[model samples]
Target: MAELQEFIDDRPDAREVRKALAVKLVYQGYKYEEIQTILDVSLGSITSWKQAYEEDGISGLRLNHKGKKSYLTAQQREEVLSWLQTKECWELGELEYKLAFEYDVTYESKRSYYDLFDAAGISWKKTTSLNPKADEDAVAAKKKEIETLLARHRQEIEEGKLRVLLLDECHLMWGDLSGYVWGKTDQEIAVRVVNIRDKQTYYGAVDYLEGSLLLKAYNAGNSENTIDYLRYLLDQSPQSKITSFFGDGASYHRSHLVQNFLGEVNQDLSQEEWKIHCVRFAPNCPSQNPIEDIWLQAKTWVRRFCALIPSFSHLKWMFEWFIRHTTFDFATLQMYGAFSEIKY
Candidate 1:
């Protein structure tokens, strides 16, 4: 029944689509009032549609047309399809205004407006903001460079001379927990979150060669936190001939303090055989970092039991549990497409 409602909500075939949807709801034990409210049809219409469906199956419903024909003609529909093909962003209210003023057509409701968009094979969805600074060609070149460097590092790892680690920071707040879960289609499933600005920022690093994760929670990310993390890593693996760590182009990663900590010559910028090396990932490119995958898995696990997580301390405990219990595979992480996509 939920699936049927989704189908009905998504397309604008005809008025009969609503009747068909009503019939399904009726069969699913929905009261006429509920059906009328959901489908935006009168009780009389709902009764007639149900009777028509019961008397003659789908054929009876098809015979009943509730109103005049759609305002969008065949040519206009073709125009809409072409516009959709252009992949331009549109607001529903803007489209509604365009329909009313430009085409002299008005939909009965927002539902009907969306139905027309669905008919045009368009959908409303959540979107991520794209970085305007990102360049495809530069990203491709950087990806190739990273892959070549990784291949060389892999050879060093085999010789027990180098260890490669990917690092990133995650803001762990009460609102961070959200994902699809089993719930009634007509209602929303709410996750509890605190109103206070209380959160923890975790600086996390994963050794792709050993599949071991190092994590530290902080109030915020800065040069101090980044340098502190690098110092911790240096102490953890002091004997390694070379420890190369990859991170995003955050200011802290390139700060003078961090550079000095890594033993780099800040003035001349010459390469030195330091025990630890800091490598910055390409700007606006996160797919290259596998630590993101680890955080995703951990956050997913935390969201699964969102009801049980009541406090910040409990959230930290859950993070600890996930990290200790989960056995992240090294070979799988190394072969992740973020690395393979660059290989020619």
Candidate 2:
């Protein structure tokens, strides 16, 4: 409207002018059609301009509101956003501790003091694909199919009154980078790292639980290592009379070496003759295997206390430690409460 233009023109740097116009147009009794006729602007423009003035005050009265912050001070917004991006967080109340430790001053702060940090509009996130590399629905269906087959086997054995060992393998890569919460994001990202010292070295494990175990890593996953891992498990739990083994459709699990090893192990114990029945999971359905959850559980522990791990060996050691302690705690044994058990 001519009135709005006149107001902006007359009031040089008059921030309050925008609030006055908004109150009159929207809050006070004024017909938008009549107001538009008087101002010579469209309803959309009026809406846009009114919102603009409310946000920027007098500066918002401008035709556009760009490169300006709302509620958040520039430095405060930057600091808070940057902190959120890292693995560190400073409490609003204890911010005085940081002040005292660094600047030797204890400044008081209110809980709402962080409101400006939130109003900076930094928390919005863009949607990302659950499986950026593959179809999620297909993957889920495959996992379900594998689970169903295993469930059928378990049901049959249970009805017939039998105890069977579910033998399998897991590999530990020395340079496994695992996943991380890095890069420019409001969401977490998973990045793989190569093991420089060793590539194909693996670990095999066989477990007989109601569910399945899965070995996860980058492309460095293979079968020879899986069998070797199984051998180790056999050595430790020699008394375990497992009857069968199940694995996902990875090339390693189906390889000649793995089959030969299992055959040899079976032949050695001919008297017991535990059935070497094997079932392969639907291809690429790692989620169906409970072992994947095991790895995720391990990684979550690393994120809780430590930020950057120095090397792959450290990662392995810490992971083993976390797993041992986590398994011991009753709180952790309960589904989804595993991480809460870490007293340290």
Candidate 3:
């Protein structure tokens, strides 16, 4: 420990002297945060410096003191870039290992490796979720069918005789309250979870013409709840004679219980004149329903204020409040050619 101060005093290079000083601070029982403020270095760098000094003594604190030089020839750099482009994703350690083994090079700073990634046109990004079972042809055909239906009801919709609602269900868990936020690097941001698996079921519908949202919280998403939600939508739009629902192919949506309720509601009316009509999108293709995006927006809104939520009931209240109050103007609402070919 005493030798670290002597090394810091004797080192000619300012960079090496700084590394030695950080190591000496750690030996003197200084916290990483305090050392960071004192040295203006990151906690990660302080940790690495302490580990390096413990493993290799004073020699480890010296920057590029050994035979190693952080350099690669132009051709070698191009080769590394080519190797990076061969894969869709990578870990930083993989690049470090490749440079150490193949090119016999190592950079003193991680920024150099990041520069290589930039040169290779690679970036850190979040991955999107896609269902492998989705059929493109089926999705296209369903979209076309929906477009034709909307066109046929264009006059009725404009006259307030028919209300087209894109419907979907959301199962939000308490764990969803946890999301990314900027905080100190040395500390972790955590949301206290009483029951991580505690779930809330929500039925959301977006009015096609008005772009207004309707949301209802239910105990569960079963056939009974499905029928009740449909009734709820009807009660909300009493002005519209016909209420049409576009939703996913959930089992409860097509169950006999819901069908029986629909039968009772539209007993005398013809299929075209039915008071309540339900249309299912392509199986496993959630992207076909614009209400899915509305649900996402609602969840994102609640997650933004997750820290203030004290209980799951409060979370549910916030989630429902955001959905019911917000008017959606998302472009996805017009994906089925709404407001263009099929005018309001």
Candidate 4:
């Protein structure tokens, strides 16, 4: 029933829509004879359509003129596949146009075009951006440093005397809630955004040993908020004697105000015995911090239910709720050689 509704809303060809509507009516307890009378189709056609849909799903309802036989010869198919591989990207209509104009052959079903794409080793994928300024050597050195640091404190961490936290900040905006979703191709899909620039700052830390998460929201990620967030981390782990934070080299993280706060907290202890410690990842290499992935997952969680989020406040609440409630066991967390370098 849901498939039928999606197909109907997508506004495919009139014939396919008619078949899907007929099937939907049948599922809604309409008799085959009633469906025939309403849709002006024969009883046999309605029964066959219903049977085909049950057996093959949406693909069953697809129209094929050659009765399940290939429309293009094997040689022609090879030519099409070769032509498709010549481009990095394509649209469905381009393939259709190519077949129609060059070979005078056209398949009524879009699946045929997709099948051709599959045969040519093409699949739909999202592109990711690369940081041009990231230094490979610096990232490797930082990873090694973090591994050694974690190894030095492995005994304390195992005994629950020390807590390791990977920290990062997320600047979420109303525009961030907008992402890819399946919808009607003929109609424009839009999220109602009162102000795209309206933003919220979030500080998140994921426990390296326990997989627990700590999240806090603030007006901005300045020195003041950074200090408070550090205090919040300390407050959460009162039983632990030491808390170590690994994060990016944001200016506020190393600001004098934040440094002064840390100094006050560990004034009586030596550097090794300080209650709180902070380490910076290599510059411009966010991939080194697993907390970056946590932030991304939180935003993705909120975006999945963006339709139900009534306002920016609600969006922020939903984002925080997911982070605080979920236990993160990301594979990237193990990429820093913690498991091999540090004995549990």
Model 1 residue 176 CA deviation in Å: 1.5
Candidate 1, position 237, lDDT: 74
Ranking by TM-score: 3, 4, 1, 2
Q: Candidate 4 — which residues are off by over 4 angstroms? A: 1-117, 180-186, 337-344
Residue 341 displacement in candidate 1 (angstroms): 20
**Candidate 3 stretches greater than 4 Å from native:** 1-66, 241-246, 340-344
Q: For each candidate, how many residue pairs have backbone atoms clashing (under 3 Å)?
A: 0, 12, 0, 0
Q: Pick the candidate with the highest lDDT.
A: 3
**Candidate ranking (lDDT, best to worst):** 3, 4, 1, 2
Off by over 4 Å in 1: 1-67, 71-79, 93-121, 135-138, 178-192, 210-212, 264-273, 327-344
Give the whole-model CA lDDT for all candidates, comma-separated: 0.69, 0.47, 0.81, 0.79
| Deviation (Å) of 123 in candidate 3 | 2.7
Q: What is the C-alpha RMSD of each candidate to the true structure, in Å?
A: 10.2, 16.2, 5.6, 11.8
Model 3 per-residue lDDT tens digits across residues 90-195? 9876887788668767664667888999999999898987889999999999888989888887788777788888888899899889877778998988877899
Worst lDDT run of 10 residues, candidate 2, spans 335-344
Candidate 1: residue pairs that collide:
none
Model 2, C-alpha of 121: deviation from truth (Å): 20
Top TM-score prediction, candidate number = 3
Q: What's the CA error at residue 15 for candidate 1, in Å?
A: 11
The worst-scoring run of ten residues by lDDT in candidate 4 lies at 62-71
